[model samples]
Target chain A: MSHGLASRAGRISAQIGIVVAIFLFWEVAVQTGMANARVLPPPSLVLPRAVAMLGDPVVLYNLWITSAQVLLAFVLVAPIGIAIGLLLGESDYFGRAFKPFFFFLASVPKSVFLPVFILAFGIGFTQKVAFGMFQAIFVLVISAIAAAESVSSDFLKTARAYGASRRQLYLDIYLPAMLPVIVEGLRLGMIFNITGVLFAEMYVSRAGLGHLVSTWGMSFQMVNLFAGILLAAALSIAVNEALRWYENKVGAWRG
Target chain B: MSMRTAGGNDDRSGWILLLKNPLVLRLACLGMILAFWEIAPRMGWVSPVMLAPLSATVISGVTDFGVFARNLGVTFGSLALALLIALGGGGAVGLLLGSVRPLRTTLLPIMSSIYAVPLVVVYPVFTAWAGIGVESKVLFGGLYGFFPMLLATAAGVRTVDGGYMVAARSMGATRFQMIRHIMLPAALPSIMSGVRIGSAMTAIGVVVAEMMAATAGIGFLITQNRTMFNTAEVYFGVFLVVVLAGTIDWAVSVIERRAGSSYPRKVRTL
Candidate 1:
């Protein structure tokens, strides 16, 4: 146990050392003119600006807008995607007809339809939400179907034999068995949700994190651009970690 | 749903079989969508200004085939270049990390955290660095494809059987020979899967970068047409993108399948 703890400690220090080394390299390269400071600002500048952006009401508002759009899209996604997935999983004919379609849709970057959404919905909050929904639904539906399909037929049979009603069977048996995988899907879908909203914003938006970063880049505000990108990255990582934590907690029963 | 039951009687009649076949049903569904597309604008269900009829879209695609071909060449050329860089760099780094436990332990977590961040958000930074040209697009796509390959290669390396390593070491094989003959073959399936995902991601990165801001490419064509209210051209560009994406996915799946089939799946025996 002590040896394991020591190795983990070493690993943690190594991680920190590596991050510091990277920053040092960036600073040295910029200072030495080996790297263009204009394009690649040193961490010294970017980090401070990132911290400042955190306190900036304008930046906070943009972050909130992007987050709200993603959350709204996910809310719409869960029920509709789950219902469709359950239907596809339970009905053989539906599975045969739609599974491949959804699979194809999942692989194909649904962002190609951003222009259509922009044209139809206009470049506003609705457009971003709609785009996020389009991007996330296929991923959620596919996972939900897989989750449903993973439950054993024998389990369902036993539950029905026990006089479990349809709703009870779903609530008690199907849901518990499927929740872990569905949660996994939700985690993955959330990434797409973030991506979709950000992409729409980047392409065209009056206010959002994506717009801030893109606009900063265009105007050659290197520090702000890097900070915006870093902020976005931090947000994504945080959300990803939270979902992962939830997945582990919920899936503990699977062990 | 009721019509799906037509095959339950096992009548073996051609008409009933045709009606009941899953493939036919799938095709019929697609046909319905195409029919709807063809009729929706003309029937005034949706304004023609927003959506063009399927016939018009197809005609636009055919007439502007030269322009489409040129832009497609640009997109594919950049994708090819980007994939080459991603494979070389990511594969080398992955191999090194996979072979070294200390490095893997220290770096993998950091890399994955960075990976979780949608790299698309960083495209603007690339544009700032490399300009809104093929260079930035290539760089963006290359970065997008890099993580999948690296992670997969490392995961694959871990899966190499201990017996294989022991057998190689007992044969007095050099480290290079052992890696080339055993580790690489063992890792082929995982690497191929990575390639499948990486290629798709590379395409997405390039297309999205172009869509966001670009001088030329299929994605640019779609956006440019959208700006000009050339709805038919926009649809045509979208059609091409779908076809391009589908073709790449199909091609990679074939390669992955071939690689996967080379090694018999492991089965436990008492």
Candidate 2:
């Protein structure tokens, strides 16, 4: 390997070493009574319980629900958000009027919207789906609008000079231009999808991974709670990393 | 073209322009929404429980303004305090780690991964450790702000241009001089994005924690009304939160723009 590759390998190993050291310290602290076991359970205790719980029926069922919510939300948000984004990009008048509202909507406490959603959709699975969809939609819409706007005007002018039809201009030029940004929006939407679904579940739903985590928390089951949290984190990290990897592979065109 | 006056009063085009003004269009849209909100419940087309009529909501919001204002002040004050600490502390830590190569390689990945952990789930942890008070809410808000702020600051410092550094060094500049004259100026825009992001999240953290644990504050008020099925008051609380969030975002952006105006804009690349 070249010096660059070797240096990268060294850095990765050093990171792994630090993480292992921290876990070792944590286990020692709890086992030796240096830390309170009830409040801060060691990784050794938590890890086994976490692995066992992964096979539990309740854990599996709730995990399915959370994943389903995210999937459904992506299905809904991408089409509707992009359609509105296209409208905003094409019409300067509507864009001026609506973009600020969407901008403001983006910043607002989505938690406030949760109660409204729960009330409207009922305190059930649909409510969480609705919340998650809203959470992801604006991310898509805003990014889509910016992406569409950013298509080079010079390209449009050049196509027009060649007597290209409007349909041809959009299909051959703007659509391809918007692809990379839409992928980025897809990544953000997925992250927000998990977060929103989890938020709604944590607050009200009696089922799902979020509720399981909360149940553990309230019962003072520190080991179990940490395990559940770590499990959820692992899922999030998996999705985040997967999307990032895919983006890298497809986004070489961006070079 | 042959029939119309050239420059004098032409009410026809004036009406057309008035019709097309975005402000007018926006108001028209709001008016349509208000109209539907008022008519739907009374017409029995939609349940009032789901959406309280505009008039009833206005009355409830006005009558409850005192309560709302007090809660708003509490929530806003906690967020402001949390933001102050996060900006100062996170920025310092980010600068420190960002300046060191060994530390950055080891810790940056850990921090970024931790950032994706759904922090809202951990509200109960904060509640348990800190107890349900303004302090717990502030701490949670601080946590939210710190991660984004630090990441931005660190990335900003790390990405400072090598050419700029070389030019400064060739002029016999000291380390402090290089940082002040070159590093900070280049990093300002990225740091500004972090501040804006952190500021936006501050409201979310405070209000979510308050909703989960507090006895008072806007989130608590909404929950209280929600339990009673008082849709108007619930709507009122939600509106206030939206306003608070919007004000924070607008203020932060305005500040960022002012701070960054003198700097040359950096074109983002994929």
Candidate 3:
């Protein structure tokens, strides 16, 4: 047991070691003029720039815009996507019939439709939220349909046999049962939604993290650009960890 | 006989019983959805300026075939080249890593973490390195395709049944014989599924990269038309992408299904 733990610790350290090694190499390259600072900024430069930029109102607002779009996307799409899934998933006929629509939508890059979304909802926060939600809706609906279909008829029959109320039946039985798949779908939905919103902002928006990325590119501020990219990466990772925590929490709640 | 079995067990010849197939029936179900897209604008159920009539989009496509065809050809070229690089390089790396326990333990988690990041947003970095054109698109698409294929290949290799390996070893089976008779067939399904997902994502990544900034590509065409508010042309471009991406997805799905049928999955893969 001790040996196993040691090896596990060794493996983790190796992972960390590699990441540090890469950064160290980058810093050395920048210092030695082996790499162009104008094109790619090292961590030594980017971290300080990122810290300074965090105090700027525009940077903070852009960050908020990106985060809010992700939040709005999940808030708007989750229930609607699940509802649509339930509506269509209740019947096998409807499920098969609508499968093609889901397939086509899911396969296509939702970012390309950014213009359509901007036109429909305008270039404000609404457009970003709508675009993110649109991509997520397909993912959630597909998962929801699968979850609904997987609910055993025997359980429903037993509940009905016991004269369970409609709300109680769904709350006590269906919700708990399907939480895993639902959370999984939600995670997948959110990841793509985040990407979709970022892509939309980069393509056309006047403000947001993605826009900041473009702005930095135009001004040739490699330090700020690298920092922006890193910040976005950190945001994505944070969101991912949050969702995973929620999934585990749901599992515990059921237990 | 089941409707599927009656269709010949293989979908290719199975179409001889096409009328009896569930696949066809499901496709038939999509007709109304397609019709809604086509007729909604024409019938003024939606704004004509917003959504073009399907026929109008097609007419635009035909009329401006030169522009559409050129962009499409370039996009396809980039995608094809990207997939080829991904399959060859990623497949080898994933195979080696999966078969080696220490490597898998060290690398797989890092790959998984990187996978969740919005790699597409790093397009500026790629453009800076490779410049804004086919090279950048191909690289973006290739990286997108590479991760999935690698992860899948690793998962496939690791999940091979130990019992089979043990039996082969005991029987004095040579390494080549063991791989050919046992490893290849056993891991084929997971590898095929990886390829399936890789192809789909490659199409998406390439198109989106093109859309973001491009001198020539289908996505560029769509963007140009949209900027001018030429609704029909934009619609046509989107339609072409839908058809192209959908076709690639469908074709890969068929291959994955067939490749996976020979060996059932023992471990769940993402």
In candidate 2, stretches whose alpha carbon ends up further than 4 angstroms from where it belongs are A1-4, A153-175, B1-23, B167-181, B257-270
For candidate 3, give the lDDT of residue B228: 87
- Mind giving the per-residue lDDT tens digits that candidate 3 earns over B3-45? 3343555656644465455556666656766798798988889
| Candidate 1, A174-218: lDDT as tens digits | 878888888888888888889889989999899899989889988
Q: What is candidate 2's lDDT per residue for B28-95, written digit by digit as tens?
A: 78888889989998898888889888889889999988998898888988888889877877888888
lDDT (0 to 1) per candidate: 0.86, 0.83, 0.82
Show pairs that collide, candidate 3: none
Q: What would the per-residue lDDT of candidate 3 be over residues A1-255, giving only the tens digit for each residue?
A: 255888989999999998888889999998899988778787898988888888989899999989888898899899999888876788654665566677567767666677677556767888888889987999898888877877778888999999999998989788877787788789889998998888888888888899899777656667788888888887888888788788888767545
Score candidate 3 by lDDT. Answer: 0.82
Error of 3 at A243 (Å): 1.2
Model 3 misplaced regions, further than 4 Å: A1-11, A32-34, A152-172, A249-255, B1-46, B167-181, B254-270
The DockQ assigned to candidate 2 is 0.60
Residues B1-270 of candidate 1 have per-residue lDDT tens digits of 454455546556675577666767788889999999999999999988778999999999999999999999999988898888677778878888887878888898788777789777888888877888999889988998899888888888877787888878998999999888788888887777778788878888888989988999999999999998898998889888889988988998887778767766562221
lDDT of 2 by residue, A102-190 (tens): 77666666777887886688888888888998988888888888888878888889999999998999787787778777777888888
Ten contiguous residues with the weakest lDDT in model 3 chain A: A91-100
Please tell me how candidate 2 rates in CAPRI terms: medium
Name the best candidate (by TM-score): 1
True contacts kept of each: 0.66, 0.55, 0.43
